[model samples]
Target: MTKIIFKEHDGKEHPVDVENGMTVMEAAIKNMIPGIDADCGGACACATCHVYVDPAWVDKVGKPESMEEDMLDFAFDVRENSRLSCQIKVTDALDGLIVTTPEKQF
Candidate 1:
């Protein structure tokens, strides 16, 4: 299982065990992490699951695709490290991935 750490805007941290092949958004929603609204349910149509991938793990998490990039443009609090969690697939190499939720979702 991969260990996913979700840091909220209020500075609260939540860690969850996620299986490989599942998307970051799926893990968050399954674990009840509050920040991810997942309004489109991983269809890449909504940006409510927007998050900032920790800089240290950027290389590991890799870059987003053109489609995900387009959706992120609609997200609140966009950042250099911003990503749509639904676009990230978990892997054994990403066992200790850390993601921070944006302050708001719209």
Candidate 2:
């Protein structure tokens, strides 16, 4: 399993072990990590699951695709490291991935 760390805007952190191939949003919901609503599931249909991937892990996590980028336009406080958690797939390479959620999902 891969371990992913979800950090809330308020500095709270939730660490979870997730199987490979699962999306970050899935891990968050399954582990009850607050702040990631994932209103559209993992379909990348909404920006409710927006997160800011830690700079250190950005390369491993990679950039979002065009579709995801478009959806991210609706996320709050978007930055260079901003991404839709649902667009990030968990993998062994992402074992220690860290992502921070926005103050509000909308």
Candidate 3:
């Protein structure tokens, strides 16, 4: 399992152990992390699972794919590091990944 951190808009931190091959959004939903609505259920069809990859981990997480990028156009508060949590698969290399939720999910 990989240890990932989800920081809420209010500055709350939720640390969770995510299984290999699981998406980041799956971990947040399983752990009850707030701000990750995941309305599309990791389908990459919606932006409710939007998150800003911690700047320090951006390189490791890499950029969002074209489809994910297209969906992100509907996200709130998009940033250079903004990504759809559903698009980020957990891996051993991302054991310490950190992501921050936006002020709003819509």
The residue pairs found clashing in candidate 3 are: none
Cα deviation of 3 in candidate 1 (Å)? 0.2
**1 or 2: which has the higher TM-score?**
1
**Tens-digit per-residue lDDT, 6-90, candidate 1:** 9998879999999999999999999999999999999999999999999999999999899998998899979989999999999
Return the top candidate by lDDT.
1
lDDT of 2 by residue, 1-106 (tens): 9889889999988989999998999999999899989999888898999999999999998989999999999999999999999988898999999999999977
For each candidate, the alpha-carbon lDDT, in order, equals 0.94, 0.92, 0.93
Regions of candidate 1 where Cα sits further than 4 Å from its true position: none
Q: Cα miss at 89, model 1 (Å)?
A: 0.3
TM-score of 2: 0.97
